[model samples]
Target chain A: MSSHSTRRGVASVMTSSTYRPASAAEARFLAEYDASAYATPLVTVDPVIVTLRDEQLAVLLVKREEHPFLGSWGLPGGFIDIRNDADPEACAVRKLKEKAAFVSPYLEQVKTVGGRERDPRGWSLTVLFFALIAEDDVPPIDKRLAKWFPLSALPDAMAFDHRALIDCAIRRIRAKAEYTALPAHLLPQRFTLSKMQRVFELVLQRRLTAGAFRRRIEPLVEPIADCFETASHRPAQVYRLRPDSGSLIFEQPLKGARRK
Target chain B: MSSHSTRRGVASVMTSSTYRPASAAEARFLAEYDASAYATPLVTVDPVIVTLRDEQLAVLLVKREEHPFLGSWGLPGGFIDIRNDADPEACAVRKLKEKAAFVSPYLEQVKTVGGRERDPRGWSLTVLFFALIAEDDVPPIDKRLAKWFPLSALPDAMAFDHRALIDCAIRRIRAKAEYTALPAHLLPQRFTLSKMQRVFELVLQRRLTAGAFRRRIEPLVEPIADCFETASHRPAQVYRLRPDSGSLIFEQPLKGARRK
Candidate 1:
């Protein structure tokens, strides 16, 4: 469904056709849209399924098969079955299992995306879901359709407004990693300092000095009894998530530390 | 429109004539259906507008006027006009201005919410926007429909799926205030240590010792040239956000401060 290049390149060009150029009258009208005229509320779910594979953070994507910029890569998501599920998270989980054969280790409501022309179809509102998964644990691919793309690199063409969605997701994920326990999901049940550092580096898209990185993450790491032997010069010490720690481990650090 | 009680409560006791129940088979089919069948992409937006008034942190809210939960309070937001504005932030600003007649001092895309059943109308998705405005700066309400409710005392009934939406927004805001400059938005552009501490307390929903709170935020605050003279006790020193610190001041302290 996706083009040969990457989705970012394709998104830069696709103009939403459903959005009529607003006239001065239309602008004024929308600004004063009588609250009583239309009040239908629309709901949808977007999943930001993040995985760490090959020491790089990636997101699960699906190629679109329909029009309105068809043949593009975007997050695997869809509308909620209001008649069935009582909450949005239930619907998001259901969609993830159906689309990617994947169950998220960590899931939370990220934000909502609601724009008039964000969808060529109509006034569509969306709820975003953020999922964290271990790269190695990613379930078998649903080749019938679906794939995982690194955050740094995505498909050329993305269907609908997914390119913008993906971009927003990446920024949130990187910012969240600094302050939350979210990065732990990217690692195995047990891992070493170096391995953890790699996950941080990939998400941050920059290298951190080992001393500083360890200092930053030290509070959240409870050393496991076992050690993992790596190809490196020394056997690395394994650590597990501190039981008492909260979901997020880092906030954005001072400006100097964040510089590449 | 919303009744004074919960939707679940109303849905349970309401007669079949008012709310139809689907067959088990139909429910199961929907639960298991490939969610991609209804993949019409739509763009939407949700705004998290926060303000501090009367020593309490509050968010701008409007009562829903339609069914599915009419008369319930919720964050005021609407669809982004892609034709008028190319940027998501710009769209969010427009929504705020149009609906509430207020411009946010701090606005950023918090995350996206996309779940199928999130909207009862149809397949709609939403992009969540968060803004922080000093309570005093809030413009006169031109729209009689909107209201601002304290974060601590949120209204019991919220429209649509907004209870969940506001819950997520509050968590992000509270968590952000602990380690970032976000709390400053609730304070006057120039404020005192006591005032700053009060904003943190209201947002975090926890009592921090004056000594500890001061120590924690001291690094983030730069003593301004001015002070606020109170009727009682010594004059309090005022501070402003360090301009060079940028958006990521909170990440460091949060990473280092392990939860007990």
Candidate 2:
């Protein structure tokens, strides 16, 4: 049996006449297309907003007010506004602003999720984005539906494949943390090395030695001269991401037990 | 002015009556949705099929047979068969088979590109995938249009934003080559360390010292007793990816002019 015969055809509904290409060749090609050749799937941008809270990673989720998954919790997302936004990242940032009333300095497209059984309506494709924000800057929540839940104490059931999406995002963060300064996205502008080490431990869920971590991080960051005085302790030296740091690739921070 | 007012709404054309959810509560919810609430964009899966040829990176592109850039070269792709395929990867593999009659051993989802202007047929989203195959194993071309073009000498005109897509794939391959054992995908089942280093140089466009390259690759590969005699030299040791190597992350292979 041929795979082509077994596969169902996707119907197209795009009318080519509406598009006005810059070039005459492109315009001629568009004018000759079969507009209804294939069916388009619904695409959405879903952001997994995360931050460090109480020495643990936390994710922000909103409760669904309407049907489909009424009262069920899910990641804050919406259909991409194709007419207004230039790209998926813009659509995701807009969704973040609309749903969470927060702006993230660091947002990276992590993965794309699509399947026949993922949605109840029809075929839907969601581009998952990993967004990290500082804990202190989390905006005031006016909408009663949104809340930050610690990773350890997540809700029993999420609206869709959100639990899996969160898992993927965490994996990306931890994997990236090995070579890149990803935890900086979750910390404040200037922070102590001790504070940064805590962020790594929270994300990796493993305690790392101070000396080893300092050696790993020393080249990636530069001293700021300014000191941060913690309550009941002497001032600790603060550091910031180096000006020349460009996705600084290094050896894995924590390794299999080596010579001490 | 509210940003919401300026954003164009996505129309939902998914008929609720056709969907029959497993859960009674979910079934009730799906039946109640107004299908026309949002508009969905056309989603596609575009795979960049890459192989090493003549110590250079080559990409496989098929000439467009139908309208919407007819006769022009583009990455082999098709509208996702949402009803039949289980996921995007399956859709990509199917498209690859249909267009190039190629089956890749290593395939990974790279990125998702979406916007209003990406497709001349209206708003569309394309999930880009990176697929690598051995040069000798490439299937015989039954279609007259498909051809492998060196990355340095691409055609002047490519369908859609395929040029940008190719550039993105190259960037990802180079960035990933710094940490992971990704080049193994482009080589045969077993190979010499010298042959593997050449693949790296081709992808990264840089010359690496033998000692340094070997040191970086030591942990990721396992040596085989079998060896292949070269034209002018003795037999060289062969290696393959370690059984336990899972996206093996390592330190940057080359540093600034190390010990000349």
lDDT of each: 0.62, 0.74
Total clashing pairs in model 1: 63
* Model 1: per-residue Cα lDDT at residue A24: 57
Query: Pick by TM-score: which candidate is best?
Result: 2
lDDT of 1: 0.62
Q: Compute DockQ for each candidate against the true complex.
A: 0.10, 0.31
Tell me each candidate's TM-score: 0.67, 0.87
**Residue-by-residue lDDT tens digits, candidate 1, A134-189:** 86677787876788887668877666567788777778777776666567778877
What is the DockQ score, from 0 to 1, of model 2? 0.31
The true-versus-predicted C-alpha distance at residue B131 of model 1, in Å, is 4.1
Top candidate (lDDT) = 2
What is the alpha-carbon RMSD of candidate 2 to the true structure?
A: 7.2
